[model samples]
Target chain A: MLNELRKIQKKHGYVSEDSIKKLSKKTGIPVSIIYGVTTFYAKLHTKPTGKYIIEICDSPSCYLNGSLDIIKYLERKLDIKSGQTTQDKKFSLFIDSCIGCCDEAPAMLINGKPYTKLTKEKIDKILKKCKS
Target chain B: MQILRKTDQKAYAKAKKLGPKGVVKILKDKGLTGRGGASFPTGLKWEMVLKEKEKEKYIICNADEGEPGTFKDKFILVNNPELVIEGILIAAYTIKATRAYIYLRGEYEYLENKIRNVIKKVKAKTKSKANIELIVGQGAYICGDETAIIASIEGKRGQPRKKPPFPTVHGLYGKPTIINNLETFANVPLAILFDDWDSKLTLFSLSGDVTKPGVYELPVGTNLRKLVELGKPKHKVKAVYFGCFGGCMPYSNINLTNENVCGKDCMLGAHTIIVVDEKHSIVDMATNVAKFYEFESCGKCTPCREGTMRILNILENISLLEARKRDLETLQELAEVVKETSLCGLGQTATQHLLNALKFFRKEFEEKCR
Candidate 1:
């Protein structure tokens, strides 16, 4: 099962359906259970997950700090909504709850690194360099 | 996925062994209180979990520290994951449980990943004889409560239930379970590493009116006066809004000091302290906090569901042109009910901030209510 997971990893990318299913088998938790869990939870995904799943905080503070317009700029640049997959399949946008970095409001995740106090121009610059 | 020793806190030592018995001893020595908003006795909580007679026991570290003005758990979990990890290990050992789980907030995906990575590293380096699972809660405030946390971890939506057959007796898979806050667990590593001497390490995040608005680690007896003095740039700190959710104190406490302050002395939360700066409107701050509880109320029980919405209505009235002196009295009455007679701790304790803010700054509340 481990070998099959490795082969699947080699064939696909970082995350795979078989690997998630294998985790289900190893844990004695049903395959569908794992599938449901992966899908139900916003963080987990069955398919290959991007290295950077940028989640822009759309909470009130971020909204006050102009996160919606920032999201629009991101959508135009990446050509996708907040939770949709991109064409390049490199970046995926996650509509996040309050990131709690309200002091540095208008925060977003870049490769799991939280970047706060963002502007449209700054976001564009970050996107140019952000991989996934 | 390696352990990050990069903590701003004064965390230097590592506890090689702090099994259940050692924890009891430390609890006795430090007179350590629970860090989960409630300053209840840690020893008593331990006794509750230990008294339970169940073969399949569980230990859960509550990393869902989601109080709006609080980020103490995030700091510890992100910068110093081992502190909580060591604590979780000790809890599991004490409860005689082979399975330990850390339940974090869904919105805190970044922090959750931080913990998950550390768990992986810990598993790889040390042979985890006990099976510890890292679980993320799907965005619910009530999950901060032990019962809801248990439900969420068991692959179910997080919601509160009756608690006479408390979590210690029947939790997670109909087994005895122990759940504690992140700061509580972080303290465990200190209990293990340090001599059983009484000392407290604090992480106070100074925001709003203060000069520095970051998490600061200090010692036990530091006065709030000195702490505020340190936070000042040039202007005097007019007020303070320390702790989160459940407990709140005066603005003068933050103004009073620049030295270290411990748990039992002041109104700081389990591991967080916030100072409201001069420029930010305290009225606006209080109203925003009131609205936060109103928005996050899980609507499980009557006292919380309707009460919080009514509070929101009053707050919106204050924001608009309909607030009255009677509204303040009604808000206070509702706060008492929500604090005392709610289904879970969220509603029961959610009113603490609003009440504290209003009580401390009644003039501000009165003025806002117009």
Candidate 2:
């Protein structure tokens, strides 16, 4: 039922307890089990997030190619830490393990679209597009 | 070195002329194997799935290349998606599968539309009965494992199930399923179409401390020294890590061949070759890899869930200079236990990086401890 939760979250921003209860009633799966699954996956969020989710890959390959610099740049540009959403709910930044784009190191997903071989200038452009 | 450059149009025509059984015979003759870590014979897998009496057999193409240092699948998907589709269609026709799903990684969300369009085009052109759907993963590395992938497709937490009922027998909502990796499926068209198909040519993802790090199509037995030459090391190479967190070998020990790389104890998983130069610290590398496992463990069972965390803790302590000499012995013992006791391949091979590090880079661990 993780996919169901994902759909609900996609529609409603987060899988609220009320939606979980409704899903439980609909699928006959217990609310507790549904909640456990939501907490298990990193992609599923209990709280509301920003309009755009920026997930930066911090795995070894990305790290070797300076993924940390991208993370720092995002943190500074957004004025928030990795797990936090901006006050305006414009963006939510996170450090993901690996996004399977190691061929293009220093890669990340800007609202699920990949931006690879990141640079300070490229980050500025991406952030500008998000802000606009 | 240029390996697989152009699609063999002649072979494609030949395979199409030969029908399903004839193509199967050619695959059996070629002895093509799965490109996804396991390296099981592709022909044998197709034959087994074909023999299943179940009517609702499904074909799953694993595009969830989550293993770190592995991007060969992504390359194949981007460059020649049609080839992969042909492979999937060939598999479905051979197995009489009416439904198929490409379990793509969420990071590869951009490729979804393109692949869907290709599937639509192929469906229109071939008029195949199999309905293809793309299932995007939710950023879980464990889902790359076949059983866990099936669980994910079932809308459940991506945890592995017991193996008595393998996917070939019982899979994907309790029906027979044949799940092949993107690379494995991509090779199907080549195997079917070309009379001169060489199964030895495989995609390798090369990265880390190399000047020309990228995906390359090379022979199975290509030597590490030659591959290193292709990449052109930025510094003197100290060691090479094969597969993604699977195994580590000193530069001197690498043969770069599939057989030598994947022997009894070791697995040349995903053909991910990570070169570590002399300036880098093996302890730090091992610690990072252990931390990755600790984070990604599905927590279905105790051995993997708890053991990975303990291994990470021990490695971190050693890196921080808080570990005693006996801590090394404890770490080795723990790795052996985890390797033997874990349920799935992820847990079973999790400690391989650490164990191999301990074996080849003992002095690095000793220096950190001191």
RMSD of each: 7.0, 2.5
Per-residue lDDT of candidate 2, residues B1-370 (tens digit): 2224445333344556767677677788888888888888888777788888888889999998888888888887787787788778888878888799999987787888899998887666666667888887877899998999998888778898889688988889899898999988888777766667788888889887787889988887778888878998889999887754568888864566657765624567778888889988898888878878898999998999999999999999998999988899999999989989999888899998888888888999988775
**What is the Cα-based lDDT of residue B188 in candidate 1?**
61
Off by over 4 Å in 2: A1-4, A25-29, A76-79, B1-19, B262-265
Lowest-lDDT window of 10 residues in candidate 2 chain B?
B1-10
Which structure among the candidates has the greatest TM-score? 2
Residue B85 in model 2: lDDT: 80
Report the Cα lDDT for residue B180, model 2. Answer: 92
What fraction of the native alpha-carbon contacts across the interface, defined at 8 angstroms, is recovered by model 2? 0.58
Model 1: runs farther than 4 Å from truth?
A1-97, A102-113, A119-132, B1-23, B111-114, B196-198, B233-236, B247-250, B253-267, B322-326, B365-370
**Number of the top-ranking candidate, with lDDT as the measure:** 2
Q: Categorize the docking of model 1.
A: incorrect
Please give the distance, in angstroms, between residue A95's alpha carbon in candidate 2 and its true position after superposition. Answer: 1.9
